[model samples]
Target chain A: MKYYVCLMVVFLFSVQIQAQKVAVFDSYSDLEKAVLSDENTTYVVNFWATWCLPCVKELPYFEQLNSANKNLKVVLISLDFKNQYETKLLPFLKENNIKSEVVLLTDKDYNTWLSVVDKDWSGSIPATLVISKRKKKFVEKMFSDYEELNQYVNSIIN
Target chain B: MKKISVLLLFVAFIVTAAFTSIAPTPYKIGDVATDFKLKSVDGKMYSMSYYKKAKGFIVVFTCNHCPFAKKYEDRINDLAKNYKSQGYILLAINPNDPEVEPDDSYELMQQRAKEKGFVFPYLLDEGQKIYPQYGATKTPHVFLLDKNRVVKYIGAIDDNVDSAAEVKVKYLENAIAALENGKNPSPEMTKAIGCSIKSKK
Candidate 1:
């Protein structure tokens, strides 16, 4: 019985990534606190989920953006269900070697937050919100590739 | 850091905006949804015209692979099961192109309907033409129409995406009730996080 208990403990521990600091947001307004930065750094916030194929496809471009620039901040807001955070999300993150920050947003009331995120946003995954001190832009299209992603960021910064 | 002038930045921003912005849906509430013939899982072509006497239609732009759509599958089934006899038809359309998303292939859609015991017509939007016409942007998108083919309610099926048991706002059901009484559905349009419909940009 003790051996079985030890095995379960080990399994649970391995499920969570060691260094990734995942912030949990229950509401968009509450999330605004963390996203609303007054700093000089630009934040490339991508809302995604493990289930979205296009989201998963474009994720590497986001990673590229973060690694290429030291000053820019990349925040991945996962729309994955809270139940899948451990079983599916954590494992995927570890497998992909995700270096950017990941946030698990479990708020299911999308109608309330869609307008706030972007008045015209249709609440689609793989959506990006780029914010700097002077400007904030929301884009609904897929990044397509890393260059497109980088170019868009450059447009915002410059 | 070399700073670009604000005027130059604004021009670049405008160019980027063209690349970023998607074409907004031409549909608003009370718009008439066009009827189209699409092949269903049962190997039959179906259309809204066939259901001439249907009190309403819960035309869901859903697919086989979307996790959000999968989560709402049972709720959609329940909607068909309960409302079919009551003159409300659920036209479940797989709007995602199989070429772009192989998981939403016609064969898989048939398999999904069978396994899930779907009682409604699970149709395929062939040539990827139907969804754009209806302005459906994502899977599990609902466009409820009254008998006259006029769009009455558009958006999510419910408020909760995680679990059906915990759902507080039953948006589609309330809309159905409004239709029965010849009243406008409150909060006629809504939004929910869903997978973007796969197609050529």
Candidate 2:
């Protein structure tokens, strides 16, 4: 009937909207490999979480940068509690329409892996690491605007 | 009148120049920290001098809204309760600007302390001058000071943030234990993931 067709359309629309799947990284080395393996692309690895306000606020800038460029790979590493992945993280990703390659960092031993990420990083959220073949820079601060964010990325990529 | 005006301008320039030239440096390990008088949630003023008889102080820069701070609240409470009998004081300071994070206001700090049954003093850095002095970049950052007020250990509470049960290395506990034995704590500085302290620009 007509009513059945309308319900199916709504269901299909919902599925399509939430189609972006998030990759999970349980090991720090796996994530390290992912970052270093793609030599052709400049990796802008950002550590963030659903609970961190600054991280959520500046996400759009990264998404914008990802869409505007082809060589730049914006890897959004979610530090949200592993338990909240299904209930909180997935819903948030879908709601925000994030197009960047998202990954949930599932490492429990932070002390061991934090230094591996960046020696200068004091385990702060909204921190960014811009890595390319030529240079690498780690900043433990929030990017205020898109211009500032792009400047940091372009410096390494270009 | 022109000479007097010139003299006043010179004084003004000198004062501004002095302030700009001397930026406040944060205390590092082995440096003596200056005492600060801050208001607590219980409507009382507190300073490091207040706990004169104590061996050291566990100064935690934490806030209300940060989930990482919330996760460590009970552990902080436990540290205070267990260590209070052993001549140590745990002082929690909220350093995030309230305008940036409304939940971290003085009123909410009092509410959170009461709700969580915090036995220690929950103080507020009202003008936000104290945190930068200690070089605290994130919420739940801790600075352990000896009786001489020298910064002994600085950083996160532990290795595992989410679960306390499965924790292997208790960094804070180890630091306190080292101090109790008259020995310096190994791996004195540590890093843990935390929310950035909101600053009013």
Instruction: Estimate, for each residue in A1-158, the C-alpha lDDT of model 1 and write its tens digit.
Output: 99999889855654554355678889887887776565777889999998888899999999899978877898899999898888988888988878778888888889999888898888778899988885789999798899999999998887
DockQ of each: 0.66, 0.61
Q: Which candidate's TM-score is highest?
A: 2
**Which consecutive 10 residues in model 2 chain A have the weakest lDDT in total?**
A9-18
**Predicted structure with the largest DockQ when compared to the true one:** 1
User: Which tens-of-lDDT digit does each residue in A1-158 have in candidate 2?
Assistant: 99999889866765674696677788788977865577666888899999999999999999888877778888899999989999989999988877677889988777778888788787778999888884678888888899999988887677
| Candidate 1 lDDT by residue in tens digits, B99-175 | 88899999999999999999999999999778887888898899999888899999999999888898999999999
Which stretches of candidate 2 lie above 4 Å from their native place?
Answer: A1-20, B1-23
Interface quality of candidate 2 as DockQ: 0.61
lDDT to native, each model: 0.88, 0.88
C-alpha RMSD between model 2 and the true structure: 6.9
